[model samples]
Target: MRYISTRGKAPALGFEDVLLTGLATDGGLYVPESLPHFSLEEIRSWRGLSYSELAFKVMYPFVEDAVPADDFRSMLDDTYQVFAHDAVAPLVQLDTNEWVMELFRGPTLAFKDFALQLLGRLLDYVLEKRNQHVVIMGATSGDTGSAAIEGCRKCKHVDIFILHPHERVSEVQRRQMTTVTGDNIHNIAIRGNFDDCQRMVKASFGDQSFLGGKTQLAAVNSINWARIMAQIVYYFHASLALGGPDRSMAFSVPTGNFGDIFAGYLARQMGLPISQLVIATNRNDILHRFLSGNRYEQHQLEHTISPSMDIMVSSNFERLLFDLLGRNGDEVRSLLEEAQSGPVSIEDYRWKHMRKLFDSAAIDDDTTCAMIREIFEHNEYLLDPHTAIGVKAARLCRRDKAVPMITLGTAHPAKFPDAVARSGVVSQPSLPKHLSDLFEREERFTVLDHDLKTVQQFMAEHWKHA
Candidate 1:
């Protein structure tokens, strides 16, 4: 399978090259030139397979030519074996028609582990074969930083640097990344918001002369094709578990970077019979504004209790635009450029087309907490703040009550005790046994100003290869 950049200027690359190259040289995210489709019979045939087995069947087509079948299957076996649950992504019934898919069973209790664990293995397989070393530069609002560090910490070849907003993320989220000590892992706290850290990572990837041309950068963010590919598997997993192809499944994803819901869209393209995808957001609701009308503009970033969804810019939205605008790179570029002056809308026809299958809602902190307390009182099930937003959105925007609606439980509740307390719960959520000692562990990190040169210089000084 070949991957093409959203801007349509960079050379199309195979899966291996796309895995190694984060942002395309043209400052665009890479998407597949053509998607692999599965017939109903084909999707149904694998309904009984395990999560790892289903992942191999779903993802093999993308990397078939780049990685050998045996080696790839072995890597899949290793990637999923680390998850804490027997069923990696399991479903729990919250209501007769509503369910929650738990996605925090991995080593780092968040949804990102499904992708990053596999990404680390894939990087090791490819980099070791080429006998080369690389660096990972990623920005996370909360979960991605910890998951990326956990995923890449063991790899001998890549030195991974993750930047998160200082004093912005929750205490549990910060410790998850800062407490993991490794020669290859470095965490930086930028004195700014998530957008600033993301901008610095993009700038460094766009021009890597800061590394003295000695190394290429890998991406662990949703911008990487591997992360997206790994995410698509879970959508298929959820559907197959819920009896797919016979009945339609709908998803409500608490979105920040747009990667998770975009995976559901790809699942529909791959014939999983997804009925609806709800773009659930917190107060920082750029996606809701865009889908509600068509304006894609930035606003002031608010530090909400659901800090993971506190992003002004949704980067993965570009990939969806590439497909929605008929893959017209020039048109995509023009719309983005036009947004620099003020708000910009897509062609009316395009916006209408996207609205056909997608629904959106922006939930505030009070509503998020209310939903959390209400669910706990009704069903005795506590939801993390982000998942509470998703559950609220599902109830508000559900198109069909006949179809099963699944809200993605993105992270463990222990990650955000403040939200739990505000929900009026008497008992706080406790960390897992493995992380029972998280509070006592010594932390390590560097605080840096939100400047490109300072961030890059710090990376250059600390990078093992440099």
Candidate 2:
């Protein structure tokens, strides 16, 4: 299948090329030229397939030209074999008509592992065949850095550098990124917020000289189409488990970079029997405001309990807006640039169009903590802060048609012990064996200012030096 850049200038590419090149040359995200659909019979025929088989079937249409069916299948199976859960993605009922889709059952204990694991395998397969080496750079608020580090560590031909805001991430989250001793894995603690780290990564991608070198530069952030594509599978898994394409469903996603829920949007375009998609946000509620018809404005970066969602500007939302305007890349680019002038005012007609397919809400720290405590008391279920935001938002904004609303549980609660403890929900949680002794290890990182030139210089010095 061929992919088109949301911004029209970049040349259309096959799936594997889009997978490897995170952002389009025109500064747009890549999307499938046309979404592949499944007939009811075809959907039902997947009943007895293993997770790997189902993944292969769902992803084949997109990557058919770039990867053979057998080789891709082998890579998928090998990747998922290491997941902590037999069912890599599981659905657990939270109420009579509400369920939480748990997506953290992987080595890193975060939803990102679902995609990064597969990406690591896919990259190795292609690089080995061509005898090429790549330098991967990523920005993370919390989970993505750790998951990327774990996924690509020790690979002979891949070097990964993850930059995160220093001291802003939780203690466990910080250790997860810093503890990796692999020769190919490196972590940088930038002296700023997640948005700054993300900007720097994008700046690196736009560096023409860097892009032309033998040492390839790519991204693992959701800006990468492969990450978004991998995440789209879970929506189908949840929908089918809860009677999708047969009964309508809704989703509550704890959104940060907007890649995860954008995948759900793709699922709807693929003809899944889904209703409105709900976007849940923490205090950094730029997305919430956008959906509410208020001007989309970025506020001062505030560190919240749901630190991963602590983003003001969401990159993947650009993909959605580009699609929403009927793939008018020029208009999308103008809107993106105009927002820098001040708050972005969406036209009423345009907002009405967006509101038809999407719902949104924001929850503050106190309410998030209360949701965790209340859910644990009522059902003995432990939820991390990000998932708590989704649960609370789902309950508040669900429409009558949104039956069996599914909120994505993005991370394991043990990742944030302080928040869980503050909520008064006592449950014994064990650390992964590798991280069991992390508290005793000496933490190390080089802190740098948020200047783009400083970051560029650092990358130049460290390129392939890891």
Candidate 3:
């Protein structure tokens, strides 16, 4: 399938080029020119397939032109085999008509592994085919960095550099990134918030002359179309597991960059019968304000217990804007320019159209903790702060209680011990057997200022050309 830039100016590209060239030349995100849809019979036909089988069925069309069918199938099988759960993404009923899809049962213990692991394999395949080498530069709020490193560290033709806010991410989150030992992998702690880290990465991507004109740059962030493609599978996986195509489901997604939930939107576009999609957020609630009040406003960034959702600008929102404006890239550019100075709102009709498919809520830390405690006390189930926000939002914003509500459980509780403790839970979660020695592992990382030039220089000095 061909991919087009959301910003309109960039040339349409096939999946291979889009995978290698992350941010489009026109400063836009890449999307499939036309989505491949399925019939109910086709959806029904995929019921009993394994997670790998289901993934292949959902994602093969996007990559079929670029990757051989056998190679794609092998990558899907290998990528999910690493997940701790046999179901890959398992659904647990939390209450009557409410359920949680456990998506953190992978190497990084976050939903990002669902995409990044498969991304690494795809990178390896493409780079090797063309005998090319690339550097992966990504910014993470908390989970994406470690997951990117764990995902891409094994790629023979790639150098990986990930930046996260210094002392802002949890100790577990930091260690998970820094503890990995590889000559090609580097972790950077920027002396700023998640937004600063992200800004530096975007600046670097915009101009990579800092890489000395020799090495190509790629992204492991959700900006990559492949990551979004990988994530869409599990939504279908959950629906099929719970009697979908015949029955409708709603999803409450704990999102920061908006990539995870955008995958759910794509799932709905691809013939899954989704009743609603809830935009669940912590204190950083720009998305909530936009959905509920038609105001997309900028405010000072705040650190929260759910550090991953602490992002100020939701980058993937642009893709949705492009869609809402009838794929008019010029209008998206204009709206973004308006956003640069202050708050921005879409046309009234577009705003109304959004409300039909989405509902939203902004849960504060106190409420997040309360939900965590409430679920643990009543159901004996522990939810990390992010997922707690999702459950809370799902309950608050759900329109039809009859339709099954599935909140995307974004991370393993072990990753956020501080939040767990604050929830008054005496039972601390233990790391999985594979990560039992995580705390004992020595970490390697560099602390850098929030300057793009300095970061690019450091990346240049560190990595030898592959």
Candidate 4:
């Protein structure tokens, strides 16, 4: 279960090391050297297992060598106990063969809670054993900041800092991160876009001397292999619930950072019998452009109603390119380096191979609002802006009618009230009881300029050790 950097320069690491050391020194994401494939019988035997039990079975192989079996099982149990839904990740049918996987039942009301909840526990366990403390810095467009802060707030061994673009995130999204009062949890609203905040996090990962070199840096973002590993379980869970490995399933994922759909790609690689993987994007559609047109180019990041998907640069796309290029790290490095100046095109053969398994559609904000209204009128299902893009893409880009298509419901609609309002729906969605007082709570966060050095200094001054 060793992890290798996509750029071929960093040393191979075990699960724990990869969990802590995100964004390899060579500026590549880490991926498992080899994936564990499940036999058809193995996949069938998982039917009727509890969500926690199923997660343990799917993820144990990756961490079995690194974590004691009992401890890992206990952590999985504790991590999922907080989800609001009994099924953890439940499936609700929208049409004959169309379904939505509800992933927002977690504490933060977003799909990120599925991974961040587990990551926080894992970090605490590992750090406690080694008697070490690390700084956890992450960038979120909206949901990840709240989910990451909620997950890691109680961890004594870490100081968690999250940065989101000021005035870019929704009111619910911003308050969810800022309202939580914990000495270890710090939120920063940067005067830039999500990509700018993300760039700062990556830059800090590359050089941690700003932390005085005594404390190591950790990541709660999808760059951490643990986040991706935890996400792979839900794909298996959803498929098995709806007849999987025996029958093919298709997934439509609304993704910005590219980590969530990359998890689906990994599931198919692990013998899950997936027929198609659809990339659903908002106005910022770099991934859509790449898969549909072979044009991997960056454009100005657009602020859409779906703020979480308002990202021009997709970081996890590199991991997929690393595989599509036959695991040739040097070629991946060369392609990405070339991408800095302008668009980079893949060879026709590689592009065709990718098209065989992947399809994409870019939905605009108007289409997203219309789909929300349409779904409500037809099925009485309320979809958030992000998930609406996924449903629309699944309908437009689906290659087959018989296969069961599942769109990943990425967030609760209440998180983006403005988008929900634009749909002309009479009843506005309300926050769940746990977060009902989100607006009333006093928020504590620092508004910082987009300068990297100033941001770094702020972190240094307020860090737990300092």
lDDT value, candidate 1, whole model: 0.93
Model 1: which residue pairs collide?
Answer: none
lDDT of each: 0.93, 0.85, 0.93, 0.93
lDDT of 2 by residue, 67-128 (tens): 88899999889878888788888888888888899898888889999899988888887778
The TM-score of predicted model 2 comes to 0.96
**Model 2 score (lDDT):** 0.85
Can you write out model 3's per-residue Cα lDDT over 1-466, one digit (the tens) per residue?
Answer: 8999898999999999999999998888999999999999999999999999999999999999999999999998999999998988999999998999999999999999999999999999999999999999999998999999998998999999999999999888999999999999999999999889887877888888888888889998889999999999989999998899899999999998999999999999999999899999988999999999999997889999999999988989999999999999888888887898999888899999999999999999999999999999889999999999999999999999889999999999999999999889845788899999999999999999988888888999988672
Off by over 4 Å in 4: none
Ranking by lDDT: 4, 1, 3, 2
Candidate 1 RMSD computed on C-alpha atoms after optimal superposition onto the true structure? 0.8
lDDT digits (tens) for residues 245-302 of candidate 1: 8899999999999999999999899888998999999999999999998889899999
Instruction: For candidate 4, write residues 230-280 as lDDT tens digits.
Output: 999999999999988799999999999999999999998888999999999
